[model samples]
Target: MRRPLSLFLSAVALMMTATALAAPHPVPLSELFPNSGHARSAIIINKVLERYHYRKVKLDNAFARQVLAKYLAALDPNRAFFLARDVERFENGARRLEENLRRGELDAAFDIFRVYRMRVDERVAGALKLLDGQFDFGRAESYAFPPSSASSPSTARWAQDSAELDELWRKRVKNDFLTLRLAGKADPEIRERLQKRYEGLARRIHQFNGDDVFQTFMNAYTETLEPHTSYMSPSTSENFDISMKLSLEGIGAVLRGDNEYTVVQSTVPGGPARESGQIHAGDQIVGVAQGLDGALEDVVGWRLEDVVDKIRGPKGSVVRLQLLSKSSGSTAQTREVSLVRNEIKLEDQAAKTFVVDPLANAPGLKIGVIEIPAFYRDFAAEGAGNQDFRSTTRDVRKLVEQLVAQGVDGILIDLRANGGGSLAEATSLAGLFIDTGPVVQVKDNFGKVEVETDTDPGVAYNGPLAVLVDRDSASASEIFAAAIQDYGRGLIIGEPTFGKGTVQTLIDLNRYVPGEHNDLGRLRLTMAEFFRISGGSTQLRGVEPDIRFPGADYLTNHGERSLDNALPWTQIKPADYKRVGQVSVDRLAQQSAERIAQDVGFRMLTERSKLMRDAEAQTQVSLRETERREEDKRRERAFKELQNRFLQARGITPVDEDADQIDEDALDAQRKAIARIEVDEAARILADRILMERERQPRAVMKD
Candidate 1:
């Protein structure tokens, strides 16, 4: 028996906010595949969304229009491919998308993709024509390279006609040439590279298959509800699973497409990239080479998956990347890094401990610092009934015992750059801090709330504690931090977290239909929302630290609030939990603020962050070579001076900006030294807290 439509409609009604619309016009497109399987998949996904999604949204005409806008934005976010007329036509077809989806009609979505492909071809051809002619580097006119999603009519006016598009492409090509020229490339080499880059873009457009279009359109559909909800194609689903396991044989870096370049999102902790310490997040890979001696393949405009294929290889193989460093901001300078491919091991992410001696003024206090890369659990081993399966909770419990046995005054759990992992691990880890209580609340599609609690009766280490988080800390990280803060068991320090409080459940589409050996894609739908023990949802606001610190420059661009379709922050009834710890947060915050004001390292960080913010705000670049060179020099000088100031404050000799390159060993030592500086600062803060507590009540200090 077929399921009823009302079930799905009811769920949709709770989540969506749109009215009905008129029937859409029929659009023409090149049909690439049979609609039988696709229609079945669509029906199955909608039914799942209706029955399981946390938010029940209405798939009305108004919702369909939003889907259209989102799809267009995903396809041509920079407004470099599609014209205003194309958008208008797409909107007309979008008016009936809800009706089409109800009947499993995907023709309009494919038609819009077809138009986008044609537009890309035309633009690439026009861009190539400009490369054949001479460009004036001395021109005073400025080119606008606006951020993606800036599609206002005023901003898009430059691409109104073929002539206007031609002029725009001319400026773009000229700018590309200027960038290479500044990097010391000869004119012929610069022209050749620019020509290849545009050709690569055209090739990627022609290589798009039906699956790519389907995935893009479906993602747009899902993202209209929330940013985290998405649909993954069969191949991509497998890749994601491998990534989660951290068992893939590759350079060990997560790569994503940003504009025309493949950018590194982060390196897996035990991966070759992180071990080498040469590759950093936000670096753009413009070229990839096979072994040491292979010719460099310019990958500036290649597809992300294709770039990944080139970077992955058998273990022990070497992969070289030509990177544009993020430290240089918009006017990025290129550098080369070589790393040997290797499998990422679980030990790389294991809880590691370090001890920081008391600060000069406050002696005799030892602080234990434990760095948790992710909230991981050995699922396979646990499922096999292994009693000693590795998990964050168990490992951290052991670490806490070791630290406490060492006679430490306090502990700090460092969670910076920890993007979160197993939810079960988060709950169990929270259990280690408090005796027994509810850890977090979960709200489902039917508005049913369930409280997950820690039933354990004993605490692991009941001493002074702090949880350090940054903008990259999310999901399970937020859960653990929120629980600790709510119970007053520890101080939440550093910047606000990533604000991802929604829970996603993956649904395999093949399970519902009867097809032999069918490989239908999967849907990762938002199934629940996470609420803190204090009744606040950690959706867009994340977990605010009790004592805040100035974050890195990238923090401005990397959080849940920065996303377009993020879920709103909301609250629920406060759960029954009692504060257990007796620490004065107001006093600690005051002490930290005073220290930060007087600390030279922190002042340099603040100045650097401000400079980055200013650079990110600028949208125009001078085409003249002299002015461009001057701008680059000024930025370089500012960064060097900042570095010198930090070094001087730390009592280390500052290296000259143009000093000879340090050996690899010395370079690695320098990186480690710089990282220790931050750890030392965190240790000092914890030490200050311990001292303050001892001053108030000397008996509070724990003795072995």
Candidate 2:
């Protein structure tokens, strides 16, 4: 939503930015202590949370230990770099971490970082030396990626001694070489790249400034209270402003640093990345290249800000990304996408409409699909007194009118990946559905609760409405969907939403400190929690659909529940609103389930989803060339068979198995065809609802 709180907090993760690389000056680890104003900032942050934060948590010794664990995890996530003894050493002094941080005593924390840095140097030197040694590809060994229990690396990369750590790095280096070899790079090229990659890793570690360290420590502290709360550096805080103003010129995707990889967290609505339809959330960017002809830069280990810099350019310039999608199970192959960089146009992102005509454009009943990429509103335009200002409510109202004029029987508001914006827009949008009622409830840190009601007495295309949401739908999206479900106005038919109900306000650190204070970064602190009008808070348990689809569990552990230290789900006094009880959800869901079980496209999607889960479960891969090749061939065969099945079912000609490249138009056509399968199913679901609801009032039925 808008910065309702003095916290700007719609987007998820804003990573810390590294300093401009002007020839790396060696920063001695000993000198990396808390800066002059950190003590005051810490004390002030404590006071703010105590006064305004929704969750009243203590910063005691137990909290101190959690902070230490989080700090170490942020620095060395894979349990790599530091030995068990090193961790134990820090664990011994973990209680002091919080006390020292509050008192601005950062010497112990800096010492822990020093040990981490020294281990990195050791590993880098050893890995570089191992590159020159002859490697046996046929060796029956595998590397455990992400250090799991899955038969890859033994002991989860946690080492007892330096020798064990050396073996871990050796396997890491081997996995690196194997990945390149599979990608078809030559031995010499692989060697050069690996050397550069390893050396650059060490250099980047040395490049960490005091601000970066402080930012990491502070985030560990804030997030310990709640996952949404965070500390942003000055450079990082700039992105928050850019995102709120929609002034970014890039691929229009929000990225987060996941270990060594830059992951696509979410794409901005109407941005090149979202519009491209190829890139998706959970896709990992391994390489970034400038333009169509630029040589690919391996960005697997690069800093997040550096990778972002590479992805962004002047509007209309081409940027190429090599993505390893989460859906490409077993065959962890990367796909390249070329997106033209541009600003997020409000008009482009406005609610759009299409008609799903089962009768192929004949004079028959149709289903109007309104795809909302995000719940957006042009605050600037509205502030200028522009009656025609862009907003979800206004655009959707117009779309509904068009649908009504076109004689559609029902409407499905497609909110599949809408990651929520604009609280006012959501409340007003809900107003468009019902004549008048309470839509949502907001409860602050204090016990005060306020109800957001739809005051307008207007209904737009309210006949047999349904909302289609996926796991990515959050905040305002959840608010609208919950309202629809609560009022018995529509069927919420997809997966449960992303539970991000707590509201955060951005506070400038300098504003808290007295004169002569340093440029302390801002804090995006959680101050309020959202409860549905019916009473349940949408903080941890996002709104569950009235009819959860077969593939509702498509994204496992990908919601608010997956976040550590998230606010607990609770209930408050329910708002006094009447339920229409128009939707027979049980009857409609039973009819929909039978049809979905037999539908070819839905069945195929379910099978592919299983394959993806199986692939993701695999943390180990054979190092032997023969076994690796065999496995790749098997995965290729499976993928090819699935593709051919989908194409054959859709009545399209399948391409040859050996075909290297497919044209963009062909790919786009395939995507549209596949998407139509799901959209068509959703229409069928809504049509079933309409037919049942027709008992109250007659409506035309959709024909096959």
Q: Each candidate's TM vs. the true structure?
A: 0.90, 0.92
How many residue pairs clash (N, CA or C atoms closer than 3 angstroms) in each of the candidate models, in the order given? 8, 4
Q: Tens digits of per-residue lDDT for model 2 on 245-333?
A: 54556667777666787777777787888878888877889888888899888887777766766776667788899887666642355
Model 1, span 394-473: residue lDDT tens: 99999999999999989999988787888778888999989889999999878889998999899998888899887768
Off by over 4 Å in 2: 2-24, 147-157, 238-246, 329-331, 359-364, 654-661, 695-704
Give stretches of model 1 more than 4 Å off. Answer: 1-34, 149-158, 235-246, 515-518, 552-555, 648-661, 698-704
Clashing pairs in 2: 7-504, 7-505, 7-506, 144-153
Q: What is the C-alpha RMSD of each candidate to the true structure, in Å?
A: 7.6, 4.4
Candidate 2 lDDT (Cα, whole model)?
A: 0.76
Top candidate on lDDT is 2
